[model samples]
Target: MPISSAMAVKASSRINSMFRILWLSAIVGMLAACGSVPLPPEPPIPTAPSAPRGAPPLATPEDGAPLPPARIQGRTRWQPVRWAELPGFTDDALNEAWNAWIRGCERPVPALARLCPEVRQLSIGTPEEQRAWMMQRLQPYRVEPLAGNESLLTGYYEPQLDASRMPTAAQQVPLYRPPADLATRRPWYSRQDIDTAPQARAALRGREIAYVADPLDALALQIQGSGRLRITEADGRVSNVRLAFAGSNEQPYRSVGGWLLQQGATRDASWPGIKAWARANPQRLNELLWSNPRVTFFREEPLSEFDAAFGPRGAQGVALTPGRSVAIEKDSLPYGTPLWLSSPGPLLNLNRLVFAQDTGTAIVGPLRADYFVGWGDQAGEVAGRLKQPLALWVLWPR
Candidate 1:
């Protein structure tokens, strides 16, 4: 939804008004024809199209809500740039991004729906041809947030962990399902409340979906939203199943890593850092967990070999494509929007075409994005370590 420009909006308002008037005039004209009744005086000419090339670069209406100004920046702004400005535009494989783009097409936003056919037709093109097609059909808009020249780029992934079907002495921690009273109450319970309050525990009794041996592992799954659980049942059979997002307690989220920083306990504010702290202060683990009031609940999904390669469903209801799918502020960059990203040496892959396919609560503000690394421990390792500055350019329809 790369916010609309002022000219486009003014144009759209006039268009809407014109449509209404036409509808009304057609009704009145039919009546006049039948009884010789004079038509109402003609409405003043529709707002004149901008003179001196006054029209906005584009005037297409968006999907649902009226979008904010896109051509200009307030908190986050887009400025037109040439495709040549994009680093590795031709060098990168557009095919690598094609699948992610197709995933977005599974549920295209209205403004992007028209482009779906063309996207499907071009999916099989060579990287060079695809590059040329993008250069011709899309405009590169350099994005910058109001406060800074660049925004932070972080990573997140699906975690794989060992699990048990039921609570055991060795595997005592529990993963819960939403309770029936969840619908009846607002902000049902906080993380601290769930751990310490008898009432909260009572509410969640008999709702365990699975149990884990490590408390931190459970928290990690909650923070990541979803993951794959390798279950080891009493019968000695093990199978991998996905724990997808079900619901969350209606409580405000506080980053445990952020809380650690405020207490002057750390500088490296990543998952690994949190785990390191947990290892050293084993007794105070609950204190750290309680710092984050919000708690997330999940439901188990069967994972097939094919499904294991992709990520859990995103806000757009499409499985996230590792390395290519990114979570952006939909109000700023609509899902399915293609972005040309450039980062300094510190980032793993500096430049690539990433599709906006997912979103997260922590991923707020303009020009901000979270890169999905993929599933398993390698992905998690990369995600936890990422904290770098990034530059982004949206490849919007020309």
Candidate 2:
């Protein structure tokens, strides 16, 4: 289903406003470097983007949500650096990032947990105040990968799709929860087996949570590991829900995008390109999907108005802040560590503060990060196309 017109406008306006601030800051930095004038008052802090239409709101720390254990910081080298080494440090809207930091505090590493009370008070503080607190209490360290490879940045988003409570001619593809024997089978059925093997089908019988129209949509949701679903019930009532990652078939993931490139099937392997290829070659769609052996299962959650403001809970067990939350290789950085992320972008030039609040299977290495771009088609477009060189500096507690 098409996004509501109002949502499109709000998303567009938010993005445009963010870019404008970045552009203005760049000019201010250049002017200060030239000694042309003193720095102007800091740019207004941008507020969080509105939740997608009908999307659930975010839950807060006050909700007393259970959290996963924080991962240990990895063996990556941290070359201590002066705060001056961080680009755009002064220009970043710390108040904007404070929201992510606040979320990170929910499951903060032990050392950082002690600082949460102050972090909470700073939520309403000014950029200067937040920046001062960070500079005073945190030590900056440049992240150096053990492998000595250039750090790469990619993007992922929570896919949003329409669904039906039961299968229909148009919405025949089903998204399943873990099968009854999901745990008993080590390395459960592959994608092809779930479709072709009678035993596999039997296990998944009556297990579908919802049905989507397009197989590709199901695949996208699986790959992302979570998604938002706008569901139509048997009684014609509509509701929005989330599909959170529960378990996965133990088979290793294979990139269907990579497979497409190998076959010279299409030069553009992003979702839009893949969908275009599918439209032209419907007969080969199953072959394309089965190239990825792994299959993820999910559990459904109701989307309440209170939980609608944020993205789904991430690996860290906190709702992700659209532009501020990132999935890191736990071996590279611990969950809830703040960092200065500098990426000279072909898609977007980003020099900002972000938190390591999530992890992904493909996100490995010291320099690697998968930026969470949020939910909806606009965010989806950005996430699908973003793959850039990244530089990181960990901001650790002193």
Candidate 3:
């Protein structure tokens, strides 16, 4: 199953290349600069109100004077809790999550930087030792929405595709890099505009980085904001490379899947559903692709063995660990924060320690999260259909 393009959301801005070039350097040496990648696209869902479901009225004073607001961050009220309150706290494989934590230590926040040495040492520590250290140094806070306990957990992944350096009869659809005049244009040529307008096409004429067979394939690459492109060059050389998000055309993103549903075109709005619709109604394929006005541009990067092991660098400027890195709403949880995620899943039940290493536009709210499921087809299958109830507890420094 393929996810909807709407799942694509902006990641952090690009950091320096030092990390890539010297990836094997000590964790501290690897902290050169931060870079950006886009969050995988999931279909758009209804936006929940930023406000909590219902907040209790402020306590009145004896003199009928309203009490000042309680100190809090974002739209959440952090309720402190005991470590035992977290379900499956002792069951998670702490060592499995240590890799993500160590990555965070590469460029740790002021509060957590001091703990880097300990975090690294504990990478191979026993679960009991790690658990004890956490309990000794961190406080757990239940992340509560102001109005309600409603929370959502979704999944996202990097897409992989076969591509070519030059356009071929089979691989005619082009994936482009940003145009020279992109910044000057308030909103660059749209998906439809680029397809139909000569001038718009001219701007991107020499900017094609690679070409793939299906238009939807190109769109998926754009929607994911980044992907693995196994490219066969014109000279008969083949290599696997990463296409990282460079920029968007500034046009607002619209959900083509949602459009299909609204138009009564199909009940299945997943990527597979969209593909089926495209196949059945080739004449309307352009109309479907053009429903989303935004266009994402990407730059190519060499995918090294080390890089291949992890997903693209997230908003936190570190490579994301599969099942261990989660895209969060930055307003509610800062990057690098450790979290206990418990979800009663109809697809997959997850109770583990994950990190707030990325953020997505759709991954908004105090409790909402998008789990990074890694790359390739298997991961895409999980990301495409994962939507379940969620609960989170943030482990903060004591």
Candidate 4:
């Protein structure tokens, strides 16, 4: 029998409600399993004092006095959570859980609230607890999820001491090599063996694609062999752009589907310029200029190596680390973070020191990090050899 439209809609709604409940239950369970630390007893909320018979009204902001308006401009709209919303969690338990989470957070609650007004209405037990709860709830949103083993999603669970322990030279050794099957990986371009324009264009046919720039020279490096370009406009209109590799000699560029608009010719690689150019070129632009590389890039060499190689000139003829090694950037994990890196083979085993001090033209995504291995052959070798899992820890500042 065919189901009625009304019945289908009702079933969908019920399913959505159940899904929300399940998600909420999972979050609560995870928090419970983590175990909340005990907090000092909160002082009782004060009752409003009865007004004296002749009490004057509060002064208005418009008066000569310096009092500001009671309601500030550009305030966020968030309402307090109702008691019924948190069914099973006790107020004290919730408060303790929130505080434990907040104490470890880099950004405190009030600062976070200014940025994310949605947190204002969330129930956090008492007024003091509100800030802590808000911080805990917001942590998940700030982290950009990466595609990797699900275990990576939880990150390193153990608490690290807040001190800068320069890894002793002895302790800094490669840990493991990537499996042989994964070790021989090459860049998409290298893998395809496409070095010419005709070959690149032919390879890109009917596939989505993008490009990255060399850190030092900022040269347009084509990332070929993806399926179809998905160009999303500011208005959320998604259009398919054609990917065309301009060959080794021809500058790699992006091509929109429509005729080139006047704005297309003038659009530089900047975000606004790219959008405007995309709008104008509609179809003529050769390639999207700002696309990031998909490979797991890292800023190469440990801080010790950097200092020994470049710090205050120990040797005159020794080449200083180029942007690839000295200026590579990590994700928001911050500079000076220690990462336990493993790649294929016994030779590659070592825990290396990395700082999140630099950013690269191609390193934008969360799971991604770019290692500068000094330019030319060294950089190429390191870039080519970087296809393995890396465990990272932000050495907390003392």
Candidate 5:
């Protein structure tokens, strides 16, 4: 195998070239496999400066846009009242008897029935007569049951009567003027003032709350304070009202409930703090936020002509027109759902709107409703008119 030196060199060069070609081919195969295998993209890095230390991010609407408008839709039917054609309905004795029946006092009903058998007879009469009779009976009492319940009435009852009974005509005099101003009057509380005193303390303790039938009415109550209330009757008559003050031990939670909820002040949320603030500022607490200079207390009646004015054509009575009533599941019905009720009645008028915001003490059953008549004469008239059974529809935002 001994060959020439030139020939040996040539053979070595050929061997080296073969090895280089094989290495290149192996590198190319690895590059092709890598191209087929997918790799994940890298996440982006924030370029903006960091927020200031210890500062919370500003709150904004989701997606940095304003919220959508509320979509509310519903209809209320009109419910009308039918009055009785009984003789002597407007007489003084019958007026007294009617008032007694509306009060529903056990003592008064029997006496009232004896005096005005028409009321008893009408209770079972045609719906129209029943309504009319009921109105005539309830007018003098000034009490109307709240909507949606048969047993629970929401109108104010006269304060406990004193022993020296005054004639009904004599009682009418004090009803016009506002109750004596209590602001200048010394606090009814002495160190001995046990009842309202304890209640005041408990209210601070978060045990008592305030409530009202209507939010607007609550405003009036706040302004009137703890003194007597006055109402204006439909016939331009006035009367004095003795209001029931929250007993010292009994909480006024129901009376002022709306005010408390509106204020965002709660017994739970710093009761002691509120008490301290109230103690420091007594005058500010007594002043009502929604006091109207033009609106005065109507001593002889609870409602004004304005209160009775409803519907497109200011009709004289309440009517529940068709396609306006609504029914809601017991669980979903919230207080103060305005409704338009409709049903068959003597008055073929259109359905009307009413505030469904009040709840009866006894109106817990489902599918019931309460209709409010403006206070005093008109109220009595309207109450008497509401005898026909009509379906109600609740109007709400869709």
Candidate 6:
């Protein structure tokens, strides 16, 4: 199903590549200069790794009492739990989660910022060491859905698509940059109107960075809000470019799957299911698309070696570590909070430590969350099939 009608928040560049490059160059130059004359070795001071391109420095925790009891609304009741209550805590690859936790510090939760120095030290440690650190520094609190014990967990991913720099007969669907009046306009022309209206077409003139063959593929990027565009140039050289979120047409989001279900067109609403219906009824594709008035816009970011590793930056403003990062309603669970999320077998046996690093228009409630499996088709498959019951235990500061 689609996400909520809640505004799909957009983000801009947080990382400055030129700055990182210049800093690294200066460091290299200094090291080269020092090589001529050997000096007494200095004790190693653990240097904090350069953070993701644009993320802000971790804020120093306020000098005060503990965070006012994290009482969040939307059906929440925190039940105190011990580290022993966390399922698969010992078995989890806390090392993988350590990297994620580190990225999270770039946008650390106010309460957790003070502990980042200790969290930083765990990066090179073994999983057992990481687990011990977590146990000693954090307290687990099981968040119950005051309504019941059960809650829903779904998934989302970064989708990759083949595209072209210029429009052709085969690649006519255009992916646009944000129009100038996007903010001034209440609701810009929708997906349908953008194609049909002359004024709308004029508004977005000369802004297309690439064109694709499938509208659904384009729609996938819009829904995900960010993606990679593998551009096949006229010379046959292919280059990958990232489409970071620029803005969106100020219209409410409506899930086409929900429209299909409501219209009695399909029961299976997964991405594959939706694609199947699109293929079967090609003529109604526009009808399905127009159901959602919202149109997401993007700006091309030069894909770098750094980008090749992690998924897009989430609402928390940090590059997400795939498989170890998850999005929950930020209002319910503060950003950068560590969590133990588990699901039953035969569906998703997700018993692991995940950082709450992102949020979604639809992700609300104390127990609800969306697992970020990773990027590409395999990740998409997992995300599409993941609508299962879940349990959560937030590891808070003691």
Q: Count the backbone clashes (under 3 Å) in each candidate.
A: 5, 7, 12, 43, 70, 3
Task: Order the candidates by lDDT, highest first.
Answer: 2, 3, 1, 6, 5, 4
Residue 252 of model 4 has an lDDT of: 26
Candidate 2 Cα misplacement greater than 4 A, ranges: 1-73
lDDT by residue for model 4 (42-152), tens: 323222233356663222111232321221111111122221122221222333223222222212223321321222122223433342232222221112234432111
Model 3, 237-331: lDDT tens digits are 99999988899998888878889999999999877778889999999988998999888999999999979989998898888999999999898
Where model 5 places Cα greater than 4 Å from the true spot, the runs are: 1-332, 346-350
Candidate with the larger lDDT of 1 and 3: 3
Rate residue 17 of model 3 by lDDT.
Answer: 18
* Candidate 5: tens digits of C-alpha lDDT, residues 99-166: 22222211221222232223222222333333223332221111122344332112211111211112
- TM-scores for all candidates: the values are 0.79, 0.81, 0.81, 0.23, 0.24, 0.81
lDDT of each: 0.75, 0.79, 0.76, 0.28, 0.29, 0.75
* Tens-digit lDDT string for candidate 2 (283-335): 99999999999999999999988567788888887889989999998867888
Candidate 5 lDDT at 273 equals: 39
Error of 5 at 176 (Å): 18
| Best by the lDDT measure | 2
Model 2 residue 103 lDDT? 77
